[model samples]
Target: GVLPLAGLGAWVAGAGPVVLPLVIACFGLVAWGLHRRRARADCGETKIHKEGVKP
Candidate 1:
């Protein structure tokens, strides 16, 4: 989880200050992907419901 990653990053920070941005970017990408997937799923469900399909 992010907590463990945060702790590890804190330790790593003592050596350098580059991993933080990489970690943040990775989380941002993951969040964006999940949001897009959910939006697509909702759109599909709406279409199915509108068509009277019992989903």
Candidate 2:
């Protein structure tokens, strides 16, 4: 929440050019991490579901 507020403040302060890419990158990283975590969970707990699914 604070992170979003800080980014919003930065945008309001005319720092979009610099902050936008960083915010986008951060969201990308978070999404990637979440996907990896879910994939790992599926791989661990669902052998039938993970059959033939290569890493």
Which is the leading candidate under TM-score? 1
lDDT of 2 by residue, 1-55 (tens): 6999897776756975777788789999999999999999888778865675755
lDDT of 2: 0.82
Worst 10 residues of 2 by lDDT: 46-55
What are the Cα lDDT values of the candidates? 0.86, 0.82
RMSD of each: 3.5, 6.5
Clashing pairs in 2: none
Worst 10 residues of 1 by lDDT: 14-23
Q: Which ranges of candidate 1 are over 4 A from the true structure? A: 1-9, 53-55
